[model samples]
Target: MTSTTTTGQERKAPGRPRNAQADEAILDAVLTLMAEGQSAAAVSIESVAAKAGVGKATIYRRWPNKEALLIDAVRSMKGPIPELAGVSARADLIAMVTANRSSRVQEFGKVTACLLPELMKDEQLRQMHHAVMEPRREVMREILRRGIASGELRADLNIELTLLMLSGPSMAQGLFGTETGVPLEEFPVVLVDALLRGAAA
Candidate 1:
């Protein structure tokens, strides 16, 4: 009765109306299992169904395979990109960084840490992860480009390297412990300021 859209096309499945509650339970079940240190390969459809309290047929009606289900679960957990203020590159970068760190710490931080190592090793899953991440990366790229064009950042700034510089440490802090001792509340300011010191026009 419900339809899902992909790539601008609506896909209607022949079944009863999709249950929103059931969908949430299934995705939450996947995150719970992953957070508990279960590898993607270890999470079977039956196990997910058992944990979600849905019949296997219910899951099958929603997802074609375990990988598809897992990807959807991860996507659900990722949430949307935070709306940028678009006032200044420095402010936008800080906002983006702050939201990312908060999301990692408050959202499914453990689930991500547990999944990344295993997921990155698989070509298909790696590609899927890239697909999910690329949009966010592009946003950052655009912000950096704007900064350079607007004379806020050095024209010679290497956007790719700057992107890594902006994101790498926050990601590391999320995966490992926050060794920087810069409280999460202050990290974005500290990070963006430091980068701007060298990068500012």
Candidate 2:
């Protein structure tokens, strides 16, 4: 696998002996800095090194550039999305969405909404964005799979497209931040219910 390396010479594979402590420091710094933007957040490499309390060399060793570093930082910040196991598709979707609506995951979502435009400018950042989000996508996929097995969803339903449909309300209205405009919780519930009715056997 390719990596963003600062030392041109290929010494060893990245993440081989990953330091959990340093990863935490970097991720914490990212959440704070991204939320702070250019204000309290320092864009300078020196500032990040100081804040992380790691040698500048260590930071450079892991990242190719500032954007690469920022991307990795955010990439490491993801956590498991909540799931309502052993439930109907309708119930699972509602429960999972409700969990995210009130959890820190929503904060990252808020962060993504604010940073995605800038992230799109850099190819590395875009990949990082995808890497960070891939797990969440899988989470939804798992939920759909469960729903299908339980006979709560259509046998021929397109999982990917259906996932998008499930997420429409959150994406359109900005579930937590409301920058995209607020959508009522009941609206998501109603929409999901309608979807269940349509997809049900």
Most lDDT-accurate candidate: 1
Runs of candidate 2 with Cα error greater than 4 angstroms are 1-18, 39-42, 81-108, 154-162, 165-201
Stretches of model 1 off by over 4 angstroms after superposition:
1-18, 102-107, 179-186, 198-201
TM-scores, one per candidate: 0.76, 0.58
Candidate 1 lDDT by residue in tens digits, 1-201: 122224112223334345777887888898888777788889989999999999999999878778767666666654357788888999989877775665534456767767777788879767776776677778889999999899999999999999899878766776776688777689999999998986556
Error (Å) of candidate 2 at residue 30 is: 1.9
Across residues 1-201, which tens digit of lDDT does each residue of candidate 2 receive? 133432121223346445656756765666666666652234667777777788888777666678776665444444335545655777777765664454344555556566667777778667766665666677778878888887877788899998778766565555354553335545557667877777557
